[model samples]
Target: MPKSLKSRGGEEELQCGPVFTVFAMGTRMTFVTEEEGINVFLNSKHVNFELAVQKPVYCTASVPKNIFFTLHEKLYITMKGKMGPFNIHQFTGKLIDELHEQLGNLGSHGIMDLNILVRDLLYPATVNTVFNKGLIPTDKGELQEFYQHFETYDEGFEYGSQMPEWLLRNWSKSKKWLLEVLEKNITHIKAYKSEKDNSVTIMQAVQDVIEMEKSELIPNYALLMLWASLSNAVPIAFWTLAFVLSHPDIHRAIKEDIASVFGSAGKDKMKVTEDELKKLPLTKWCVLEAIRLRAPGVLARKVVKAVNIMNFTIPPGDLLMVSPFWLHRNPKYFPEPELFKPERWRKANLEKHAFLDGFIGFGGGKFQCPGRWFALLEIEICLILMLYKYDCYLLDPLPKQSDLHLVGVPKPEGQCRIEYRKRI
Candidate 1:
């Protein structure tokens, strides 16, 4: 047996699989790959997991500041009340308009980098949807600066986790910039009261919490929420479009599905509502399958007490890691997991297959991503309009997955190019 597969008891116990451990930057971490072991850890009550507080294996051993954790907890609570499917659907419509305007500027036909297109459309649209344009920076340079800071902070999580305390102290520049942006936005909203006439945005909701609790951490919470809303969205959108266009059958079926639901496509803008989008099963399935294939990241938890899972005894104070990227491809749940088969998600087949239980692309249990439903709505709307209004194809073959970062969404090894021509 290979050394990688040998368990703590050696090759004789390879059937149990090895529980790999690595020491990085003075922090000890455990990596689990078996399906049963991960499921047990994720669903276990003894395992404690807090997204903002947990010291992810990739980051320094120091715990996040108390204020940061408080901000996250409060924001999560506030989002439960403010972010609903209805609100997300309404935001999706506005997002469609913004994307339409931007795409129009690109002309009728040309080769474009898929990553750039996805970022350009999502960044501003997400800001508007979450905070309203009145609160965000109006200056293009400031906006660009903010975006660069965010990317820097996000990319740093991979290496920062392995750095010591002295290096970690220097990592606050990105956090400071993000907080400054949020503070300015909050001050603007308070002074102008612009959110009074319009629907309550996430910014306004966080402001309310700040007022009620009299906590200074609200601005940081707002910044965290903004990051959460923007981070994984672009990658998910890119993969969804890439996979749909890569497969001839899937692409044709999606276009036909859009035509059936929205009528014959033409020069006029395609107005698709959330209700209408729900009717396109194949389109939704294609997006789900894409996520299962390309979305790679791990769920980290710290054991608060000694726990026994899958006949292995795990000690208290150990870091536990589970990767959905591996779980989603498990042969026990998904047959021929490498293939892109949207039909596997059909209603009748889904009922018979227990694969749904194995699908943890969005995490699981109480720790499940709060923005999941909204994320799906946003992706579906983008895919629907792009397919309906334009004819698009891959200009470059799908690149291998790279940058499997510990904190953020994974990206293609290199740029995936695509060509688009407006359909009239």
Candidate 2:
């Protein structure tokens, strides 16, 4: 076991397999060494298990396969069927249609208005998803309070002004509905509060958590679920669509795949079943490739305490930022890093780009996002439908990377408009 970084007080470790990583806040340490772009303090004595509230020592922790195993356990425990409320159904399907209709009515400047429509459809659905599970009061006051505390505490926001404001505003509006749901179903949520009861129903645990931390954890956790579930899917959809429209080869391959799976002409309306979805392997690979090219948001961990790095000692309270954007695009792992090739995912290079281990799109460890399965399913369904139902193209000549505050959280730079004509 490699001596992983420890907290300043020499407490427990992050336990990323043998190589531990510590993150804390306000720990003043040089970000990078002369040789390493960021001098990650691999082993610090003070590291703890808590989501590092601040920066600890920046170091690359050896994440074992067990971390992934733990993540799978946590993911199943946290999010399984709860995605319907996060507007995955609406945002991925109806909302896109609504946005298209809205654009038809409102036109280009509708981008400003979109900030409203998107929130209207998204926030309430998100709050209710949690509230229905007995998570929190969706009341305006409760939500406002929740928003206030999260803004002050949670480190997810690197650009406070850009992301938090949007999150808070939507939260404020949806609070009342959320509260009503919680009030209606309080008893069921309480049943799952005990941590000792590993078999506790996930919904109950979620509710118990919110009920316990009405202040920070519940509200932010609810919102974070929404962000994690949708953040990559939306931008991924935008880019994937753009790619389909621009790349004739990809378009042809996908069309062939779709036709082979279902049929060729006349059958315009097709609801993709789980089995039919399995057949669209090429389409799935294309979506994956698009994510590789466009979705590379950053992940940050706060150090709960501090420890030592080499000869130098790092005090407690600091943050470590890792960019999977760089890792995902590394030429060493992905040959011709800039190229968009779905063939890479085939069995020959199955070990390429780091296994289920290095991929940060859904994150890793116990703290990884829970709704990844939902997100992936939703992406697959949406892409399948778009490719089948219509011929679409990007209005702009040069498609640019979407602006996601964090890695994989992508928002198109311009109002991403696609000219769609029914495939006849």
Candidate 3:
């Protein structure tokens, strides 16, 4: 399914102006391009999220129909409570520890793979923040072993949904291992009490459901949650750092922002608070720019009632889609559409003006991601840690945003390396 989506890479749709239609997997998909139509597509009472994602999820994510409906409800509620802006600062301590530990291994200077560096650092840090540190082995060698299977699982996720599992032995093995790990994590969480403070993590938030065994589908639920949450966010972090570090002026600006908020690194271990994060509008703009530039190529829904959008009627049951990748590129909303310009955001009124209309890093209206706050906060801190601790820039040619994404921001493609030296 991801391969099919990648095949065209929005080129065919770009020719169709605001809207077009295509048939895939026995479904008619209406792709909405302009912000006006996108606004309608996202908010129409007739258009919905669950029905739109059910099939692909069942196929690739191993979630069956009976449990799918209830599982998402549970997740959505938990996500709102755990990942929302109200208490976003809670996750920073674990994230700081994890990022510091990973980045510390650089030992002052080295060259590294852009993809591998981000993947290894983000995955366990994410896992620990989302679940618990003990959920996966913390030692470097053992953690890498676990992440290897997760890598395979993540890499093959799209194909795994459509193709037979038997054909992809490696992804199959990795999927099994991931399920077992999640199941064990669930069991362990249910049996144990926190030795530390009583701040609720998502795993603990869902303990009632897992403990009662109301659904035997707990493992698959955990796996899907992991993928959906991390898939876009981790790559957004990669792009944010890539764009900032490669541009010396932006890099310097980001560093200055960090200096004002957290003081200089190396004097003592740098600590960040949520209030301090708000001070760095430049850093936030840079991060938002990466998300805008590398935003997901598509989002989808199923129209349940006939709806009129852009002088045309979209019939019920047709799969409706929108391309933020193209909407963000609309020159009226964003001048010089192809360039990475963080400064543009500063000139515009983000709330009252049309800028927010074009910003679809999270989805629109009712379809907006519940994890939006968590994802943004996570990226900000990761960027802060990187700039605070290292002097880094690209060594090889800069990587282009890969068309290889299944959802959210695509990963960086092409061969690229970084020359980074520890600052502290």
Candidate 4:
């Protein structure tokens, strides 16, 4: 079997042999093929690997230089302080209201592109939760425009980091516009800090950090923060919905689980609480399974010091990559790895199977995604509301995952459409 995975340009390739190098977007990266070696490298204290944002080659087109160094500590503190489980529950409730309104406007029966609808539902909810409700676009056309620009910038980053500046000029423009909007919102929040009781927002925390740091890179940091909060969420939600609805038994089981947790309320009065959501084993399992199957395939780290792993001498300055997609699918950890079985996460089996050790849906250690808890909370709310309120069916076959990028979540090759009707 070939060790190399072809790059987008087709001229360059990623070598995934026991230890091989690849030039990605003009930067050399080394991938560790063995699971034990990869685990050691990830958890090693002597290896001295820092976040990729600290390096230039991995920062991509729109990111500012040294932005991570300047903002990471403050950002981590802010996320930890503001995006706790209680806050997530409150914000998710608000988002559920918004989703219900949007669904009401769409009426009982309709065929729509799943990705587009999910994007529309999640983008506003995510922005409002992270920033404030005021930041959500009021005009339908304006919201669509913002969504398009965001998609462009996200897809551009996913495509490659080494593309010529001229080729990425439009994406840069979109990023600039996004940053400007974030900056304006941040400034507005700062100016009205005394007038309004808006202390819960992540934006407010960011403003506090900016004021304390007195950094000139507010817009740049804000852009990255916004991307972190919003990206990957909608696609994850879409995949969870698609997968659950496509499997009839799984769909019925999830609905029953939701009912058991929340009880049967009136169609207009169904309420999902934080405790109920937390207690839902099957729903959580389905979401985790979806993420394991489709989330970003690779996590990259740069070696700051030479290290030896499994008898191979890894030199300083080489990039080390580990892939969750590979580990999650390893049959040793997950029996019948290719099948979608949420029961694998049953409480009795979790510890016995050592699921956490193998699960990298969110990366491990200090660099793990800060918003992961909130992400799961938001996904739970969306899935529960969706299943409880409406009958949904995939109008098209399950879309295959596109392998265009070495990192980032797998996207559907084409639009996945679904039909939804209000439950009787």
Per-model root-mean-square deviation over C-alphas: 4.8, 11.3, 3.7, 3.8
Those runs of model 3 whose alpha carbons end farther than 4 Å from true positions after fitting are 1-14, 139-141, 164-167, 191-196, 209-213, 347-355
Computed on alpha carbons, the lDDT of every model, listed in order, comes to 0.68, 0.47, 0.74, 0.70
Q: Highest TM-score: which candidate?
A: 3
| Window of ten residues with lowest summed lDDT in model 2 | 54-63
Residue 77's lDDT in candidate 4 = 73
Across residues 249-330, which tens digit of lDDT does each residue of candidate 3 receive?
A: 8889889878877776784356677678768767767778888888877788889998777787889998888877767777
Error of 1 at 231 (Å): 1.5
Number of the predicted model whose lDDT against the real structure is largest: 3
Per-model TM-score on C-alpha atoms: 0.85, 0.58, 0.90, 0.88
Clashes in model 1: which pairs? 58-161, 59-161, 60-161
Better of 1 and 4 by lDDT: 4
Tens-digit lDDT track for model 4 on 1-424? 3455433222444555666677766676767666766776668764543555454333443444455567667677777657754455556566667666655665777889988877777777777666656666789898777888888878777543555546778887787787778767776655544223444566667767766665556666667766776778888888889899889999998888877876663477566666676577688788888887786767877777677876777777777777777677677778887777877777434323234457887777566676877787777777887788778889899887777765667777798898888776
Better of 1 and 4 by TM-score: 4
TM-score of 1: 0.85
Give per-residue lDDT, candidate 1, residue 374. Answer: 70
- List the pairs of residues colliding in candidate 4: none
Q: How high a TM-score does candidate 2 get?
A: 0.58
| Pairs in steric clash, model 3 | 60-161
Give residue 33's error in model 3 in angstroms. Answer: 1.4
